[model samples]
Target: MAATGHHGAPLLVVMGVSGSGKSVVGAALAQRLRVAFVDADDLHPPANIAKMSAGEPLDDHDRRPWLETIGEWLAGHDASGGVVACSALKRTYRDQLRHHAPRVRFLHLDGTPEVIGRRQSSRPGHFMPASLLASQFATLERLAPDEAGEVVDVDQSVDAIVQEYVDLSAVG
Candidate 1:
C-alpha cells in the first residue's frame, strides 16, 4: 500500500480485546503508513504470559511493567512513528501509554463477544486462550469522544479496516 497521508504523526496503537485482529490489522496499518510495527505481546514478561497461558486474567499490577515497556517503545519511536498492537482494554492503560508518547493515538478494533470469541477459538499457540475472551471483553472500555482516535469494527475485511483507519487519520 502507498503512504499517502498519516505523515508527521506520533505512534499509533491498534487496541482492543483478545481476537480483535490487532496484530494483523496493525501490521497492515504500519505498512500503509510506512512505519515500523510492534506487537505488545512480545514485550510481556514471562510471568504474565504464564498467567495468561494458565487461563488467568492479569491484574493491573501484573500488567504495569508490560504496559510501561510498550509505552517506552512508543517513546522510542516517536520521531519515526510506529504501530503497536496492544489490548489497551482500560482507559487508565491507554492513559499510561499516552504519558510516554504525548501525541499517541489509538485505533480501537471493536467487535461483539460472539464474533471475537469465534476468532479466539480458531487461533492457536498464543498465551491467551479462548477462555480468557470473557475477561478481555469484560475489561474493555470503549474509546471516549475526547480521545484522539476512532473505532473500526472488526467485522470488516482487514483492507477495509485499514482504509477506514487511513481515511480517519487523514482527517485527524
Candidate 2:
C-alpha cells in the first residue's frame, strides 16, 4: 500500500534526544512512505560536530545555522515530501523548522533517561557520548497539544515504533 500522512504526501521529522533511534526509525519510515530520507546529523557544521565530539553541548547560537540548513532541506522537499532524522530537542528548534516547511510534522521518539543512557553506552564511535545524555534529556521539550505530531515510546522494537508512528500520523 502507498503510504501517506494525515495530509496527502508527508514530510516527517523523526525527532528525539540522542540514542532515541531517530536515524533507524526515520529511514524505515521514509522507506515505507517511499520518500527520501536525510539525517540532520549529516547537516551539522564542523564546529558543532567538534563541540559534540569534545563533550560539549551546543548553545542556541551554535545551532542556528545548522537548524537553518535542516529547515532548508525540509523546504526543498515541500512538493515531493521526505523524512528526516533530527534531534529537535527544543520547541524553539522545531518552530524554526516549521518556519521553513509549514506542512512538516514530527514523530517524537520518547524514552526514559535510563533507557536512552543504556543505548548510548552500548553504542560506539558516535560523535555524541553517553556523558551528554543528561544534557539531551534536559534540553528536550515535549510536543505541545497544538503540535501536528505524535510521540512513540522507544521501549519496543524499532519496527514497532515505526509502525506506531505511521499509524498515528495517518490518523490525524
Candidate 3:
C-alpha cells in the first residue's frame, strides 16, 4: 500500500556519498512506508558504471542522462510514490530532480569522511571505488533551508535512522 500520511504517498530520495548507507536505509524506509524501492545506481548507463569501476569520477556530462533517467522514474511513480537510493551530491543535481519530480523529498545520510570512507573500504564488488569518495564529498551540497528534506546522521543504526524518518513523516 502507498503511504497515507498528511503528505500522501511520498516521493523520497535517499541521498548521500558512497557508503553512507543510502541503499540500506532507503530499502528499510520503503518497507516501513509500504512503498516500492529502487537503487539509482541500477539506472546508470554502462559507460557511467565503467568509468566509476575504473576509479574515475563521473563528470556532469556523464551524469546528466543518468540523472534524467532517475527523474523519469520518479515521475512515473509520482502517484504511487517510491523510494530511490542515489548519490544526489550537488544542488544542481537535486534541482534537476525536483524539476522532474517536484514533490520529491530528500533524506541526506550525513557523516564524517572518516566514518564513511571506512564503510566504503569494506564494501566489495561495488563499482564506485573508495578512491573516488573524496570527489563525491567535494561535490555534495547539503539540502538548503527551502528544500523539502531532512538530514540524518549515518553513524546511527539502520533501524534507528529508518524509525526517525518514520516518526518525522508521521507528524507531516
Candidate 4:
C-alpha cells in the first residue's frame, strides 16, 4: 500500500547537497512507500546541466527555471503522491517547491564534507563534480523548525536510512 502522510498522500522530497545519497535513498524510500520516484536532476534543462558539468556552481538565476520545472512535477503528483530526489540546498528553493505542492515534506540527507566527498569520488560520470561539493554545502540550509521534514544521517546504510524515513512518515 502507498504511504499516507498527514495529508491524503505523501509528497516527499529527498533533499540535500551533492553526494548525500539523495538519489539512492530517495528511490529506496519511494519503493518502500510504494510511490513514484523521480530524480530531479533528470529534469534539469540542458543549459543547467552544461553549466554544472563545467564545474560552475549554479546561481539562483540559473536555478529558477529548473526549480519551476520541479515544482510543476510536484504539483502534478499532488494527489497520487511521489518522491523526488533533488539537491534542494536552500530554504528558498524548498519554499518554492512547497508553494507548488503545499503538502510536500522533505527528507534532508545530512552528512559531513569528508563523508560526502568520498562518495562523490566514487561516482564516475555524474554531472556534478566533487570539485563543486564545497559550493553545494555552502548553499545548504538545514531544515528550519517550521519546515515539514526530518534529517537523516547519510553515514548509515541505505536501507537503514529509508527505514528511518518510513518510520517517521508513519508517525506523522
Candidate 5:
C-alpha cells in the first residue's frame, strides 16, 4: 500500500534520545511509506560525528546546523513524503524543523536507558557511543502530547511503533 501523511508530503522527524531506535524505525518507516529516509546522524558534519565518537555529547550549537539541514530536506521532500531519524533532544530543535517546514511532524521514540544501552551495544559501527546516553536524557525536553509532535514508546516491535506513527500522522 502507498503511504501518506496527515498532509501533503509527510515530513517525519523520527526523534529520540540516543539509542531509542530512531535509525531502525525510520528506515523501516521509510521503506513502508516508500519515501526517502534521512538519518539525521548522516547529516551530521564530520566534526560532530567525531565529537560523539570520542564519547562527547553534542550541544545545541553543534546540533542547530544539522537540524536545519534536516529541516531543509523536509522542506524539499516530495509530495508523498520523507522520514528522518534524529536525536532532537530539545523543544527548540523540534521547533526548528516545524519552523522550516510547517507541515513537518515529529515521532519521538522513547525508551529507558537500560533498553537503549543494550540496543546501542548490539549495533555495529556507529559514531554515537553508549556513554553519551545519559547526556541525551539530561538534555531532552519532553514534549506534551498536544505540542508539535507525538511521543511513542519504543518498547514495542518496530512494525507496531511505525504503525502507531503512521496512524497518528494519518489523522488530519
Candidate 6:
C-alpha cells in the first residue's frame, strides 16, 4: 500500500461508534498512506477507562478533555499526517479533533446495530465490553450532510473500506 496524496495534509480521523472497524480500517489506511497510526482509545484517561471498564458510559464532560488531548496531538501531524481510530460519535468531538488540524477529515465507519454488535461480541479483552455497546449506540450522533466527514459503510472488506476512503480523501 502506498500513500498517494498526503505529502502535505492534515491528519485523518477514521471514526465511528464502537465496533465500526475504526481500528482495522484506520490501520489499513495508514499503511496505504504510509503514515503513522494511533489508536485514540489509548489516549483516554484512567477515569474514562475505569468508567467504561465498569460497564458505565462516559458523559460529554468526561469526553471533553480526552477530545482536547487528541486535538493537541493533532498539532504534530498537521504536516505529514497520520491516521487515528477514534469513536468520535458526536459532531463536537470531530470538531475538537479538527481544531488543531483544520485539514482534519473524518471517515465514519457506518454499520447496522446487528452487524456491529456481532463484531463486538467476537472481540475480547478490551475495556469496551459488549454489555456497554447499547450505550455506545445510544450516544451515537449520525453524520449529517453539513458535517465535515465522509461516511463509509462497513459491510465490505477492510481493503475496500480503505480504498473507498483513499478515493474519497484527496489527501489520502
How many Å off is the CA of 133 in candidate 2? 0.6
Tens digits of per-residue lDDT for model 4, 54-165: 9999999999999999999999998878899998989999999999998889999999999999989999999999999999888999999999998889999999998888
Q: What are the Cα lDDT values of the candidates?
A: 0.89, 0.90, 0.90, 0.90, 0.81, 0.82
lDDT of 5 by residue, 1-172 (tens): 2244454556778888877899999999888877899888888999998988898888888888888898888888846578888877888888888887777777889888888888889877877777878888888888766565777889899999988977776663
Deviation (Å) of 20 in candidate 5:
1.0
Clashes of each: 0, 0, 0, 0, 0, 1
Worst 10 residues of 3 by lDDT: 1-10
Model 5 residue 66 CA deviation (Å) reads 1.3
For candidate 4, the 10 contiguous residues with the lowest summed lDDT are 1-10
Q: Which lDDT tens digits does candidate 6 get at residues 12-119?
A: 888877888899898888888877888999999999999998988899999999998888777787777788999988878877777787877788899988999888
**Model 1, total clashes:** 0
List TM-scores for all candidates, in order: 0.95, 0.96, 0.95, 0.96, 0.90, 0.90
Taking all chains together, the TM-score of candidate 5 against the true structure is 0.90
Q: Which ten-residue region of model 6 has the weakest summed lDDT? A: 1-10
Off by over 4 Å in 3: 1-5
Backbone collision tally, model 2: 0
Cα lDDT over the full model 2: 0.90
- Compose the digit string of candidate 3's lDDT tens values, residues 1-172: 2233446687999999999999999999888887889999999999999999999999999999999999999999998889999999999999999999999999999999999998898899999999898899999899999998888889989999998877766665
- Candidate 4 regions exceeding 4 Å error are 1-5
